[model samples]
Target: MALPTLDDPFYYLANFHTVLDWLGSRYADLLSAEERDFIAAFEALPRASRALLVRMVMRKGVDFRASRLRYAEIGDTRAAAAPLIAAGWVETDAELELAALFTLATKGELAADLAPWLAELGLSRSAGKAAWCAALAAESPAPRALPAWLPSLDDTHYRLTVDALGERFRLMFFGNLRQQWSEFVLADLGIYRFESVSLAASSRAFSRRDELEAYHHLHRCRERFDADEPLADLLAEIPREPFDNPWLERRRGRLLYKFAYRSERQGELRQALALYHDSAAPEARLRRIRVLERLARFDEAWALARCAENAPVSAAETQALGRIVPRLRRKLGLPRGAAAAPAEPERIMLTLPRSGWVEGAVAAHLSRDQAPVIYVENTLINALFGLLCWEAIFAPLPGAFFHPFHSGPADLFDEDFHARRQALFAACLAALERGDYADIVRRRFRDKHGIQSPFVAWGALDERTLALALTCIPARHLRLWFERLLGDIRANRAGMPDLIQFWPDEARYRMIEVKGPGDRLQDNQKRWLAFCAEHAMPVSVCYVSWDEGGDERERQDAQGDEGQPQGAVIEDAGAPPNSAAGGNPA
Candidate 1:
């Protein structure tokens, strides 16, 4: 469908109308009486009134100064606002608190208007807006209309009374409040392009009005929490029982986890422990263990850690537990279990002149005539995986896709994300085993080019890099990486080695992780290194040091670093194919 052009003065109105039409048709069964009446009454209003309301809705605040509500298309703002005022959608007499008044009026305007009151309070004109607001705030002035507060001022304020209703409509359309009315504008402007997914009649965000209400309730709670509301009050309002809807439940769980983390930070260990116990968040168990340990409840922490170790929720949890469990066991006077140390990857030590990006400098140092290095940190492998599993990732299962603007499935990070699309993924991965993976990936790259995706970094994955990766990286290695990604996508999708050196003639590749001085490996990076070692994949860590004394020499080397002397191999600690340099898996 062609989007409405910005040239049309009513483009925003058209976008809003599009949402209403979509909701009225697809979510008729779910609409409340208020919503239905709103749609009917809104359509009955004059085009100018509707356009004026949309303008306010798309803006930052509900309170709009009538003098500033100027639109050539909506001539005579008062005439356009009359119908909205009658419908109670736009309020001319809405009460404004002192803070709100401060927001609407200029400092000079407030100083002039409130001069008498300020004189009575002995506040000087030199006082800034904050000082004036503070002085007025102490008086506990009653909320009144803008005109009433500043009787001498000529301006009038119009508040959009149905701002909350408009937000609800937006939530229904976008499935989340994070995305706003600008999505339509962005889409029309060609700044964003989404895949055209066929949405069925049943394809709507909320299946029931209660679900909508629950989502709204959770949204309100989130807003309050973000506003730094009292944690105890927020907790009391949050429903203890989980929502039946998995999506809503996840939201509630994450919110609970956030509150628990805040409580922990505030030194309320018991409160944090209780909230963590109640939350269904994936990392709640680990947090609970940590909170318990903080409270010096060693036995409980130990027991929970053991249980979590037995059935870890994710690789991250397992990795954390490995450290926590041992400490807890030692604290409990249990004998330390001897564990084999993980094999360390080969290390390269370089003393090069400080250049631009460390990774690019390393790439230059490593690239050969037969072997070219590409800096692809976390992009190449992810892009390939995305291309191979494009269909599986975008499979139009119920609840997976509700809108055409979705870059990927809504449940991409859900626990059952992989399980739900198990068959589809299995089919996609089968191409790897069948030796037809390259063809499928190439086809997807060609067909789905320029389409928004969660994994494909289109700007980074050029045709040359793609061809080189497909040629150098083996199918078995790709399968290993893909399977690991599926195991825990949210955890494993990142932390790939920074640079990849490919030998197309030998059909071989090596991934290199670059580290500048004083930089240590992150936990995720360590995990990737271990995974590579376990599979005997050719991988190495490159440690770089700047030659402070060799500045002139380094400057010369920077011009053509490929001809510069190579870095020394400091350590070859891991198993075979222990090369000091290598390429990425794209």
Candidate 2:
């Protein structure tokens, strides 16, 4: 007994059930009602004829040769594929034709088989490749008119409408379209494995493997792009292959951001803004703001700056904006300071033994049962201030800040950064009266954008803390003093008073900066103290010294030169006997 070849009617008769079952289950949606009815006619065929039809359908082509099927897996004699020939699903060929072989070569079939059997056909490797490509170029399967009963898909929604099986199969079949078949292989769980892997020799599989490796090499090259690289070729190639990964799009955006930044730095402000338009990062917005201002589009810059005023920002961003806003205000002819708001004329400064002693003494002196005190200077103010003005500080303003600094100027002087900073400060000041302070503070703590102060921790910001902090400093005065300190956030961020003592009943709080004898005020600290005094925000400086030699120390104003003291000293404690007279504290 022997099995019939693909050309035999017996082959179709034998395999018909397999093909019909496949179509009914996996590709049932693709068949029209009439086509399905036509296919049903095959059920009436004798079992033998149906089996042959199934095999031919599984092979998925119309041409075959008995000589090619000389061997049989089931111990069947090779006979002509008569049932498929009669059914019109396949046609018999005298032998393998050059066009067919070339097709096989293009599909990675001949490459592996060629070396072992090419001598039988008398062809060279180079010549074989050319012939494969030529056949691929010329070979187009004849299109059959679609059945009338088939459901029509809107061309616009074709991609979206593809069923999962259909889509995966399409990728399997046509994923390597326009490229050599050996260049692409569907290895992902055989969704594209309609053809038998055994058809192409093992060596040809290796060749296809190499081609896929080459394709991924192109992918790696794409990841190396920076602002300085030549990107035209890469940009063009990025969309050529339909890769399914999402990170590729992100890489493209980053490249575009770098390019836009470069263009902006080159003084091509218009081009830079255009390139930056696609980037949604806050930094991109900042860059656009800077460009708009540089181009004298002040209104546009101001509008964007206002948007950034409420957006979450970092400490560095807040400081940058602080520096930028005043300049922008000056450019817009706004006054730098409010109309001479009178502050407290009397000033008090205390000297402590060391840094750790300042907060304890201040807390002891000011802490009432109703009003609790916490030690939070740079980190707390920065966190709270940054939370309120986060939008301005973290707006991703172009060239303001970078990690692992890149070459080129940061272009931080543009008016929009500063202008937005001003808007943010104003917004923070207004938020105090509207009873929305807690929510913003909550969001800031939740987001953890720039929060670093332990005292401003989410749990630490209990009801009492938030209520006091919100009302502690006068809104107008806080705005004025905060504005003055914005000149340099990094330097000024740390110099805020060591303790915040609030009187909840009185709805008042004081910012107290402590200095030890021989210690002096820094430039930023002096600026903050001056602003606080000028705006009537209750602020104090305490100078502390150790009680060595049983000494009694007096408080002094710490505002003169960097290392020198200014203002009169008031004695608070009883003087020690035999104390040296006229000795400078330093």
Candidate 3:
């Protein structure tokens, strides 16, 4: 049935399909023929009529009356559109007689559709938005969109505020404000750079007993600063002699160095170090240690650490640094030493507990008939040497150990990389059998060496190597092998179809994870867990830690029902992830 078309752009109102098409097409860069016809007729509609059509279409999607009770929200459609709705939109709603009297003032025949649609329009923001949009379309050049009114008070305000307040204020206000603000705008505004400048200025002003302003005004360098230039004479008229005086008293030089080190200025740290040698005040000494720590100069930090007897530190300082001792030991390449006990037997090696990928690495060696452990002896020696160096390098600073190295430099500690490393390595191997790569920093990863000795033979018959020999087997034996693990996936896959890879080289598959000394699990171990769980196979986790007294080998296992769990591997049906128990029976 053809309802007479109105002049309003919704002139195509008679065709509901055309109205929906128009709604969808509004988002499109290209409009269909139906939409073109509708727009053409719509352009001829009166302002009020066009507004009504826009509101009607948008309102049909929501509940209006309850919306008024649910959200008496201000600046919204429910309140503004109520006046038109009370004018008898529901036909039977003669309930609002007072509203009827108000609409009676209108000159035209009160349209039945107007009140009902108006109620719908009141139900949603879309309805109100549509009305505003239609009005915008009609009054184009008369008034632009609301975009021209809001103020652009963003970073520029902070910059101006900082300049007026001075250093201390800028540090407190801008640093706090920048940290609290979101990462994007704050970082993009160069807040951190401003912060460093503010802190430097604040340190100077505070030391001079200057009153802090509400904001900080700091000099900003347009380019990177060069420490080689005479800073005091070049930038400010301040005399460097008194300010930087070494044994002459005022702590300005030391304080400035502390500020520079905290701000990560390398040039500043070097300057601070030079003055430290000349005066070595308690504060200067601490700054020297702090700067060295920040630069990851453990040995230097340790050296300064010994002179800290006169240094007063809070109780909290000791507690905080206590956690860093282990990390320090590792960073200095200290040997973690041997595990207390023989680790449990496993086809897999202990990794640094990672989450996603497989654990342990098993590279294959192919020969005529035997792939029997060719890579074992080389791997052992590599570990022994790394451990030896770690033990020698990580130690507390000594009082008289500033003695010269027999190899060359008197102060080998102050020597550069090329000079120190060779000396350091030579010092570590003074007790062990030394030859060729013996005094070298690098541990050999491959054992293709022909000349064998006690050191090479010691790693050859290691207990961990013996365990790998027993537990690991050919990839073809994985199904039977996984039955020993505790996880569920392998057990469930016993009677079901499963995809499997038969690795012939290591004589073991990727799933036959191993555990050995000093190896930690990385993030990839979850796959092993899930793989065993999917196939209902058992999973075995081997641990290699001291077992109090005797140092025992330990293993834990988890298992479940067989033939693929009820809903095993629900994701991609492309042969069900990986099952531990065995190969695809299909």
Candidate 4:
């Protein structure tokens, strides 16, 4: 469908209309009576009225100052709003509480409107708005309309009464509240582009209206939790029973996990344990085990850890269980179980001159004329994999995609993400074994440049880097990394080595994990290192120390280093050997 051009004065209106039509066609069974009536009434309204309502809905707040609602295209705000107000879609008398009043009125207006209240409390007129609001908050005045609060002000407050309804529509369209209406504007302006996926009638975020309501409910709970609401009150409201829908269940589980995590932090172990038990979030089980161990309930933790080990929710959970299970066994005086982790990657010790970023310093120290080192923390491999598996990742599965502007499939991190497209992913991976993987990757990189994917970092994976990676990296290594990624896309997508050095002539590459002073390998990084070691991939951990005497020289070098190639200095103190055969690259 063609988006409305910005040249059109009612572009937003046109976009809103498009959304309404799409929702009506796709979610006809899911819309409530109220939502259906709203759509019909909205479509029947005058163009100006519809535009005015759309403007208010698209804006930041529900309450809008009529005098401030000036648009050249939408002449006479009062006339435009008259029909909306008549239709009960806009309210002239919105009860603004003290905080809402503070938000709506300017500082001068506040001082004038609350002159008597401020004077009664002896608040200085010169005081800041926050100070005035804080002082007036103690008075606890009832909420009042603008006219009631400011008798002399000649302005009507056009509060869009249908904001919640509009948000529901928005939620239906974008599948989440995080994406705003500006997406349409961005798409229209060519600032953002989306792949044209065929959204089948069956492809939608919510299968039923109840699922939509559950999502909305969870969203509000998350908001309340973020707003610092009382945990006990929120816990009481949060549904302990899991939703039949996995998507909604995942969301609920995530929110419960947060609440449990907060409770654990607050030393409420019992509360946290209970919440974690109720949560179906993937991490909740591991957390529950940790909390049990913390509470000295070794038996319970051991039992749960064993169950989780038998049927692991994810690779990450299994990895954590390996650690927790062993410790719990020792605490319980049980026989040692859990297998040994893979050997760590080769270690390289370097004492380089202090420079800007530690990774940059390491890259410069290790890079050679023949072998170029790049600081690709997590981008290179992910980009290569994303390019190779473009088809599998963007496979138009039911519930995977429903909207046009999705950066990636909605179920990218879901448990069944890989299972659903196992065959498609197998076909993609087969190219890696068929000696045609590089060609496929290169083609995808050229064809799908700048189109959003969860894995591809477009800015980082330039042509030069892609070419070097494709030439030097072996297909076997790519397959291993891609397999690990598909194992747990949410967890394994990150924590790659900080830098990669490529030898195009030798068709060899080495991944380097750099550690600065006081920096240590994170858990995810450790997992990645172990994975590389187990797979016999060339990887190393670089321990860097600063040369105290070269501080001044390092500063000087940094300033004049703009045009210099990476690792320009061949003889720096403690620099890695120039030859690839020097063993550890350091």
TM-score of each prediction = 0.90, 0.32, 0.19, 0.92
The TM-score between candidate 4 and the true structure equals 0.92
Each prediction's whole-model lDDT (CA) = 0.87, 0.47, 0.32, 0.86
Worst 10 residues of 3 by lDDT: 153-162
* Shift in Å, residue 77, candidate 3: 28
List CA RMSD, all candidates: 3.6, 23.0, 30.0, 3.6
The digit string of per-residue lDDT tens for model 3 on 82-171 reads 433443221111222222222222211222213443444353333443353343344332321111111221111000111212222222
Error of 1 at 21 (Å): 1.7
Task: Judge candidate 2 against the unseen true structure and give its global Cα lDDT, from 0 to 1.
Answer: 0.47
What would the per-residue lDDT of candidate 1 be over residues 1-586, giving only the tens digit for each residue?
3568988989999988888988987899988899999999999999999999999999988998998999999999989999999999988868999999999999888977799899999989988889889999999999999988888789889999898999999899889998888888888887787888778978988899899988999999999999999998888888899899889999999999999999999999998998998899999999999999998999999888889978999888888887888898888999997766886777777776677789998888667777789999999999999999998999999898887689888889998999999999999999998999999999999998888999998999999899999998999899999999999889898999999888887788888999998899998999999899788888889888876766566556556556345432223324333243343321
lDDT per residue for candidate 4 within 166-266, as digits (tens), equals 99999998899899999999998877777778789767788889888988999999999999998989998888788888889889999999999999999
Query: Which candidate wins on lDDT?
Result: 1
What's the residue-level lDDT of 152 in candidate 1? 73
> Which rank order by TM-score, best down to worst?
4, 1, 2, 3
Candidate 3, residue 253: the lDDT equals 45
Give lDDT tens digits, candidate 2, residues 1-586.
Answer: 1222445534434333433453455445545465476467667654544444444333434343333333343233122234434554444322334444343223244455445444445556667567544543354433221111111311110011112222223222322213222212222222121111111111111123333333344434545554345544554444333233223334345556776787777777887787677654346777777788899887777677666666634434443455556666777786784433334322344433333565676555445566566777664565566556655554334333321111111222332445645665566657766767657866765665323321233443545555577666555554564564465443455666777767555556666676666768774566566556665556666555543422232233343353332322333322121122101122
Tell me how far the alpha carbon of residue 549 in candidate 2 is from the true structure, in angstroms, after superposition.
6.0
TM-score of model 2 vs. true structure: 0.32
